[model samples]
Target chain A: DAGVTQSPTHLIKTRGQQVTLRCSPKSGHDTVSWYQQALGQGPQFIFQYYEEEERQRGNFPDRFSGHQFPNYSSELNVNALLLGDSALYLCASSRGQGSEKLFFGSGTQLSVL
Target chain B: GIQVEQSPPDLILQEGANSTLRCNFSDSVNNLQWFHQNPWGQLINLFYIPSGTKQNGRLSATTVATERYSLLYISSSQTTDSGVYFCAVEEYSSASKIIFGSGTRLSIRP
Candidate 1:
């Protein structure tokens, strides 16, 4: 059984540009969540998707949006990126929702140039 | 929103040494998890301990939900264990959200 997988291991974008990162959840998992991990800090919750709809969200702004496909894969799109947006974008998957164990991917390293 | 705090932001130890990391939350939590971020920035789940105590080889975790704190113990540390240890919690209010602590950076020297 493969664990969570993320595409575009690393990326570089300029301010005001948009970027989309993708994730494939672990086998047998249905819930996907996104997190932002700034340098020297812990991972902060971005949002979560379940059954093709957003179930919960964090304190992030509207520029940060996500989608969940029927297969349980997810995409995190950041529009008008800022220098402050440069961080490791991590995607985690769980069996359902609520308080459950999570399996995380390696993460996409986004650098705003 | 609940507050999560971790102690000993940074630690260095020789191989075979032992260490303990603590996490304190502001309110009672229904879920508590520990993760280790490897050098490559991969967040690996270490424990899913909401309450009670669990031991896995050289690693063990104990969560005192009543006290709103959790402890992660590492025995006979190895260089492979060098990474940032983070404590994440989920309160009953939010179903999908998890609040994470700053984490403890651990460096094990061989």
Candidate 2:
């Protein structure tokens, strides 16, 4: 079975520009969450989407937004990117809205120049 | 908000040795998981032990929800075991949000 898949394994964007990373969740999973991992750091929760609606969010700014399609696929958009935005953007999928095991994707490496 | 802390920010062990990693949370949680991030930058799920104990191969994890802590034990470590081990948890207040600790960097030498 295929695990979570993320598009644009690597991306580069200049300051003040915007970028969108996509994710296809694992089979039979409905919930999707996004995380950001800086160099030499652990992944930090960004937000979660369930049933096409955002369920919960972390301490990220408003510039960081996400969308969940009916197929359970997800997209993470970061606007006005800054050098600090350079990091690995990870996507994880779970079976339900409850606390369950999550399957993670290899992640998209974002390089904000 | 729940807070997670991992002990021994870094560790170096000889091959065939064993080690234990600890994770402590400040609040109760409904979800707890252990992940091993190899040098190649892949987060591999190790265990999803919210409570009780589970063992897989040479790795075993036990989560004591009542005590708000979890421990991961690695036996007969190999050079391939070198990586960052992270403990993630979700508080009862928000099940969708999973918070991660700083992680324990483990390096096994031959």
Candidate 3:
């Protein structure tokens, strides 16, 4: 098992630019969730997708949206990014129901200048 | 929304010392997990403890669900144990969303 995997370990963009971070969930998992972690802080839930549909969302703004594919992989897209958007983007995956454990990817470090 | 809080925002101890980190949640949760984030920013799974006691090697955890608190104990710590420990929980009202605590920064010195 390769575990959860994320692409573009590091990224840099301008304040108004858009960014997309991708993640591949672990095998035999059907749900993917995204989180944001700023410096010296814990991860904050962005949203979660199941069966290619967004199941739940956190208190994030409209600029943050996500999509889940049939394969259970996910993409987190941020538009009109702000300087405050810079943070470590984390992705976690687990079975859809009654699953207590989650497998997390290393995360993408986004630096907005 | 549920809130998670961790105690002793920062801790430093000698390699041979033992320490305890605490987590308190504001509501009932269906799931709770402990993670160790290394300097490289990877959240390594430590334990998925929701309501009881579990031991793995030199580390152990006890979760008292009725009190809405959890404790993580580390024994004979090493320098490699220096990292941020986080407690994440999924509120029973919202099963899919997970909230994380600010975390306790643990540093074990030689």
DockQ for each of the predicted structures, in order? 0.91, 0.85, 0.76
DockQ-based CAPRI category assigned to the predicted complex of candidate 1: high
Name the runs in model 1 displaced over 4 angstroms.
Answer: none
Q: Which residue segments of model 2 deviate by more than 4 Å?
A: none
Ranking according to DockQ, highest score first = 1, 2, 3
B1-110, model 3: which lDDT tens digit per residue?
Answer: 88899999999999999999999999999979999999999999999999899999999999999999999999999999999999999989987789999999999989
State which docking tier applies to candidate 3: medium
lDDT of 2 by residue, A38-103 (tens): 998889999999999999999999999999999999999999999999999999999889999988
- Candidate 3 chain B, run of 10 with poorest lDDT: B89-98
Which has the better TM-score: candidate 1, or candidate 3?
A: 1
Model 3 over residues A1-113: C-alpha lDDT tens digits?
88999999999999999999999999999999999999999999999999999888999999999999888899999999999999999999999755458889999999999
RMSD of 1: 0.7
Residue clash pairs of candidate 1: none
- TM-score on alpha carbons, each prediction: 0.98, 0.98, 0.98
RMSD of 3: 0.9
Candidate 2 per-residue lDDT over residues B1-110, each given as its tens digit = 78899988999999999999999999988889999999878899999999999999999999999999999999999999999999999988887799999999999999
Candidate 3 lDDT: 0.94
